[model samples]
Target: MDYLALLSETEQKKLLVNFSLMTDSSIFLLNENKELIFSIQAHNAQEKDNKSEIDIVDRDDANKGKGSISFSPNQKDCQRLLKDLYEQKVPFSCSYGHNYSLAGEPLIFHNNFLGVLLFAYPTSSTSIFTSQMKFLRQYLKNLFVCHYEMDNLSEEVVYNYEEFSLLTEISQLLGGILEESKICQIVIEKIQKTIPAKSIAVLLKEEKEDYFYLVAAKGLKAKRLIPEKINTQQGICGWITKIDQSILINTGQDFTSRNLKLIELIATQVGFSLGNIRLSKEREEILLGILDSLVATIEAKDPYSSGHSKRVSYYTQALCENLNLSEEVKKELVISALLHDIGKIGVPEDVLLKPGKLTPEEWKIIKNHPKRGLMIVKNINSFHNVITGIYSHHERYDGEGYPDNLKGEEIPLAGRIIAIADTFDALTTKRPYRKAFTVTQAFSIMAKNQGTQFDPHLLDIFLSCVKKGKIKKIN
Candidate 1:
């Protein structure tokens, strides 16, 4: 077994120790092959052994105790124990020791019989044997009852972890790919790994309305649920998706009601797990939509810079592709470029849309947007790490920029990439304050500032992309 699994078995030992303390005797459980699985040696047993008063029978000893220790399935006691075990189909068997003069039951498992759980005393009287046999039977009954409900929670935890890992795999495959049909199919397949569903479907909220349409489905696909408009309060699945809870169909109870509630205890658990997955997907979509809206709002403030954010985003994506970044990194770069100007929201509209040169005071307020954008993104928790790009997009290579003059390699690489994209797009796009520069003129201006404003290596890559027509210069 793995280390964690072995560590988990320690709880079984603790259980045995507690049993020993309660019964006042050493107890042990062994597999059917007679290997010790757990043990709790009694203090009194150690004392008797130290005194050398009790003769312990070693399994390998030649001078064995005559017929008392022989093993035969046909023996009267063995036959009786086997019959009881077969009849109950449970871990229950009896054994008596000639040396220690004790009687107890062994827990029979699929492979081996668990160790002998014996109670010891003297062996002089028949009445003692009769009473001890009765006590042993009751002890076995109680132990079984106690442990029947044991380890269930631990087992459930294991199942939950497996389900979580599977969901993560599905998300990695479907997230950000922009393929709706494939995303829906992959999600349905992932759900099947957890449960045997009769059918599965995804109902996306329709555009510009309070309705949901069935976009993807599996099993009986008759378009019966297609274009189905459900109120938030109607049906199990509808209510769950609306309120962000889990849904379970009841097939057994109140057939007339159509909203039957059956086996709620089992259904509730399944519903909660599925509900969590649904909520997680919804949260991702909401965050991305908010990011897009923020970028559009920033650009909308100035007619001259209407499509400037989108142009920068396109250039950033091309740069990332030329650099051969991983798919996840490429997606992150696209998002970062889109929000590079988010701080513009904090700048005064008069300064932002000014058709004339700005005064020193106006310039200072404009410069403060980068810091404000960083603060805004940091409040989101998940977007805190990406805020570096928004904050440092205007920093010069020689550390002459505002809000912490980070120089050269001291700035984050993502911030450096965004700086190049933002400058390239702004220089090529016409503004109310000034006419746009030609592609060659813009390149010349950036080349003059290389190593002083932009990283030298990134400038080299930019020139190569421009030469290869990878990044188009628009006027």
Candidate 2:
């Protein structure tokens, strides 16, 4: 409905300047609503245009080259005339005052009234066909309608691009995330940013609750504002309500059904992400329970080493924290440390409980525990990759430790990290053959063997933790 929206101000000014020089008549543009949008006034028409079809008398003598005529319409009368022209919905020419006349043509395209183009000029003294203005009327009418359609198409393309960008960002964010609140926050924020027409929010209801509660909201305004809690509902409550979870986007001003579709897709993604997070959490708890029972079995088999696996787990976590490892890596390493010595179950009780040093035969059986532990956990779907630390915990950093003799850094990162924790706990805890070494004595022994027995980098992190008194996870 707005004519200026399709035709820019700079373009309008250029049209006015060029038309004034060419036609020397007043030209005006009006919207379908009968309001004047742009205009240009040119007074001395007969001198410049030189259209011989006009039968006119100059107001001055022959010495005065060509006299000028100025015509300005009264405000009330102009509005009334434009209203009548708009209502007639057809091309027309009519006299306005004693000397001036108006000609108007409707810019209609595909049965839609786009706007009106008007031309005003002084009337000739004698009646004439007025066919002289035919070329000017047709050209101006076509140009105005052409510009209006082009602007409409440009707006649609821009809107579509914005919608695609918003959906892309939201899709990437929802992948692999396990937080309900984070999903809700992303959905609401993205919808608000894409098309800032109406206020948007994600609301959820718990099973026992009667009403759905607000989670995140973008405020309602003439323009989109920053993300905030106008209703103050946050993500703490749980999943979204079973019914009535839709985005509020009024489709009148700058919105349409396309915007509504975008919001719907975002909400569906949020719900799916929240559901997956809850399901993953439940599975992890069950899996951890089964692993706990295995740990309990290992502790019962060797009473003196009842808490050995737990202590190693504690040390491994401290090293992970000191190294600033990601949470996923840290969790895997902790689980590996707990099950590292499970293969020791296959060793004879006599050998395990011996109060003195073992012979070469007994030592050979003792060295087989790492491979034995690997064999035990190899089939577990979740522990398949996790058994790296379990199988390689005893491997020497310099390619001298065990089974495969894998060298430094060839060892998996989990293997390198758990080795330091395993050795530290073994030295400080009392075994059947030797009394407990003091904490200082344990560190002194391990420090002498860095790079040969442990990853030098991970070793440094563990030793630093001891210095900082952070090696303190307990069962």
Candidate 3:
């Protein structure tokens, strides 16, 4: 017997004894693993007859028969019985054979085996097997009522595993997707597959805003959820939204404004997942915005560098379109290029504005900006993709660069694209140290650097854009 049977036996006697009153009743309970350990005699007081209770029957009494007969429990027999019980499913009926004439059939309820009972009937009373089988049918119905309290443990375990796995997958999905509505829709789709809820929602309490918005919801007739104002105990959904709880309603005559245990349990899980998603998303947004704002501020500090980041951002998007990149990739490229010069925030104002050539040490510090920018953005949960681009934008196409010296395809496509855009914008725009080059002059300078500082094909594409005015001076 497993540990569950042992614990259940101590607390489950009165529950088991109730089945003892049935006419000719015998019960066998199976464990969660389906092992049959004990049997009970509900009413075993009937007498046996002479011709049927002969030598073969009496001799068999000394030991339970090995094949399809009452037998002492062995490891092999236990395993075999467990497998049989599992295959039979719940609420099965079978005869307990004995050598004596008065041996009776019993009903077995299988569900982690709370207890079993056996009832005997005298063979003298009925010779027909149909009458005995009729007695068996009645007991089967009563068995459902007897131990329904124990729960379908095996089924519960299965459902728990499915629910946990679904939550994990949804959490991972949320990590990659940023749109609140889409996140909620995916969550609702996942939940609907497991639970029978007509509608699902994710309500976020923006405490500073002093309002709760329905970020996501599903299964409603309307395309968008109507806003539910947050206050204490307003309405069913309102109360749930405000207090971070789950609400469930089961419609029927017996149900009168009360929550069922099952519904409450499911609601708790849903509410927790919703709240967690809201908080996590809020934190990521705040951090990402701070990083981006700082980078933009740094770029804005010098008049000569004004709109530099934005220009790079625009060119990066144009190049991404030319390359036929996916929407997600293009978005990453835009954000990455926009913040590519964030490391300049760490450079001294004097060095940034210096009209003369820099010393080797100052140049070294300036060169380390990409590495510094990477460190800044990498910590933000939502900007990991942008970090790669910011860190490697200075890398050359001909296997020459600092901060890992990654070259050519070793650099990410986003990084390589930003490198071209950054250099092009730098040449076309006037700086504190140098006059802005004319369009033709900038193109000539870029062409000379092709296959060395810049990717050869990319340089060709850039030159084509110049001739076609796809990339033009911002003047």
Best candidate (score: lDDT): 2
Per-residue CA lDDT of model 2 for 217-318, tens digit only, reads 666564654333222243322122223354443456587667668767766767677778777888888878978888888777788888998899888888
Model 3, residue 128: C-alpha shift (Å)? 19
What TM-score, computed on C-alpha atoms, does each candidate reach?
0.46, 0.67, 0.53
Q: Best to worst by lDDT, what's the order?
A: 2, 1, 3
User: What are the per-residue Cα lDDT tens digits for candidate 1 across 350-465?
Assistant: 88988888999999999898888887788887576577778888888899976789999888777888899989988888888788888898899999999999999998898789
lDDT of 3 at 6: 38
Model 3 ranges with Cα > 4 A deviation: 1-176, 195-207, 210-212, 217-219, 222-234, 239-247, 250-302, 317-339, 342-391, 400-406, 412-414, 433-449, 457-475
- Computed on alpha carbons, the lDDT of every model, listed in order, comes to 0.63, 0.70, 0.62
- Top-TM-score candidate index: 2
Name the better of 2 and 3 by lDDT: 2
TM-score of 1: 0.46
Can you tell me which runs of candidate 1 are displaced by over 4 Å? Answer: 1-278, 324-328, 473-475
Local distance difference test, candidate 2: 0.70
Q: RMSD of candidate 3 to the true fold?
A: 13.2
Looking at candidate 3, the ten consecutive residues that score lowest on lDDT are 50-59
